[model samples]
Target: MTTVPTSAPQRATAPPSEGGHRRRRSRRTRERPNWVAGLTSVVWLAIVIVPIYWIVITSFKTQSNYYAENPFAPPGEPTIANYRLVIESDFPQYFLNSVIATIGAVIPAVLVSFMAAYAIVRGRRSRLLRWTNSLFLMGLAIPLQATVIPIYLIIIQLGLYDTLLALILPSIAFAIPLSVLVLSNFIRDVPKELFDSMRIDGATERGMLWRLAFPLTRPAVVTVTVYNALQIWNGFLLPLILTQSPDKRTLPLALWSFQGQYSINVPAVLASVVLTTLPILILYVVGRRQLLSGLTVGFGK
Candidate 1:
């Protein structure tokens, strides 16, 4: 019997209509941009940028036109006289003072905070470490206003009053707690295996910190540094109370002086404000990527 060659059963295929339905379903499920979120972002951007726009425009206007006309109006004839005045005045000295104080404060604050945070995170558990951490956190709770009088008296007793050192020291002390908190969180995210490996290789605690932790924690370091820099640079009350001499003044204090007891030079004052903001703006522009990365990395973990 020549039997018909047995053939393998064919698997059934889905109809073309079924495939098309899946594609259509996927297309329908695609996400759309959120219009409400976009609108809110635009509104926030305008709120931030409008003042900057007004400041820049006011900086270019003549003193008389600055006050007489609407602030939002475009300049009829832009001039650099305000900047020129700022440059020729004690503004440069105050700017230099601010730069010095910011740098001095940031360096020590970053270094000390890093070490303290590393110790807190990695050292043996003890009441001392706990107490220290609590104290650091407490620093955040004590407003600068409450301590201003005590700080002033202390500065005078130390003969640091009227000196940039007075401003630098206090700012560092005030900034340390927040810096420690940020750095400690970042440091804690570092892998335990790395530390163990370093130890197995005979790395000292200091060596491990410098080699393993510092490089890993750079983003947090930059964030803390920038934060401290901004605080010291823009600080007013401490400088105002500590330093009495105009030559010893900081940018914020100098800006305050631009407004006389009897009259104010709004244009000159705004120009000074613009100048005062430039260094910080430049810093943010340059370090924004690091700052953002650090924030995300520190917070995400």
Candidate 2:
């Protein structure tokens, strides 16, 4: 009685943009799965994981069990006999040799490459340094296989063959090229203002290099170290051609002990394989983040 019938309130409608967004989202929801990517990843994972699974399973089995059972089957009665065989067969000697060679190569390669990269980045105005950088790039094109003969000859001439030094020297040489490439790119991305400020604080070029370049490029250093360590650790060809004595054998060569012309100890061989790969696995797990960060640092630039 006091008022006329209240007018019906209008419901608010979504704007065109919001309506379009919902439609687009619905279309996206209907899109097909990325089968190619998923399939490719599955295939690649199988390729990597199958071998690792075989190796691990074989390592736990006895030699007779390995032959009697399906190759892919898990060990029904896992034993440490294969590992014991590996230990008894001079595996420790071989492991020591590998450690020596890897450390010897990686330390020198990283250090020398870091200095060279620092020079290349900071010495851009010098024509000689530019040419030197080109030379390092050229080194990348020279395959290790092509240089094998030369390296063998050089090692022979230097009286370094049949020694861990033979393995280390060539590993360092080959490792430096890639290390310099990675590190120089990282060094180039460092802020120029930091260098200027260091100079203003009476820092010598060398001082600035050690204090600034070294610290900043640590991730790259870790990357290079891990990369080179893996290379040296897994190196079969180098050890094969360079070393001769059984006592001086690296892990790769020592694996041959599990094989004979007429008979083979498959489980023992796989035990050795597992042992050889463990150190590298540990190294990667420990430094994975640094390695990835270092590798990606220059990509954004």
Candidate 3:
């Protein structure tokens, strides 16, 4: 009877699977939809796209149709008469002026900014360089609008007033700070070993600049050029104050004049806008990738 009193065997139970439970929870959280952010993005996208749609559609419509039809509707019968009118109304002259000012200012500004940035990064130990960099940064802190009166005085004194040079000079000043700031940081991102190796191989400072640094940071250079070109192209106040002659007027000035003259012809004004926007849009499309890379140089890299 005592020998028959054996205890029953117990079944081995599995331990709690905490990791799998946690993973399931994480999956659920990851898969969860963000309604608020999605909704906000859609709202903002519409806000931007709606105006662009209206402008493009309106540009193709006749003035009578523009006023008579729904503002956002596609043209019933699109016409190029508005474009022809804008082109014939001295658009090419203003466009050429913009091209000249943009090219003149951007080239020098980029070259100077590139060298200045290289100096600032490569000569960090030099007190003079430090001071110069500080001065350039200080320039950025001062708003361009605030300096309009002083810039006007300087342009007038230099006899650059009523000339494309008037636009070019001030644009160079404004463009340099941001270009240098972006470029110096981009240069700083270059591997120190590569620089040292280049130096060891008998490369001089100038050699290293053009051969090594320039190639690596060329994206950034393109970025600044496109960005500055865009800014100078669209600049209004500078052209308004700096030049008085219609012959020296840039695209922004041309657009303003379009508004004044075609106040009643809404489609014609929009047509002029579309034509004026084409170059900038093309420039942007060409350099968009390089521009993005250049502008975002040191961030999260």
Estimated TM-score for each candidate: 0.88, 0.87, 0.91
Candidate number with the higher lDDT (2 or 3) = 3
Model 3 agreement with the true structure over 45-153: per-residue lDDT tens digits:
9999999999999999998898789998889999999999999999999999999999999999999999999999986588899899998999889998899999999
Model 1 clashes, total count:
0
Q: Rank the candidates by lDDT, best first.
A: 3, 1, 2
Q: What is the C-alpha lDDT profile of model 1 across 3-112, one tens digit per residue?
A: 89889999998677978989887887666667888999999999999999998898899978877888899889888888888788877899899999999899999999
Distance from true location, Cα of 71 in model 1, Å: 3.2
Give candidates' CA RMSD values in order: 3.4, 3.8, 3.3
User: After aligning candidate 3 to the native by TM-score, how far in Å is the CA of 107 from where it should be?
Assistant: 1.3
| lDDT of model 2 at position 29 | 75
Q: Which 10 residues in a row give candidate 2 its minimum summed lDDT?
A: 255-264
Q: Return the lDDT, model 1, position 9.
A: 92
Ten residues in sequence with the least summed lDDT for candidate 3: 292-301
lDDT-better candidate, 1 vs 3: 3
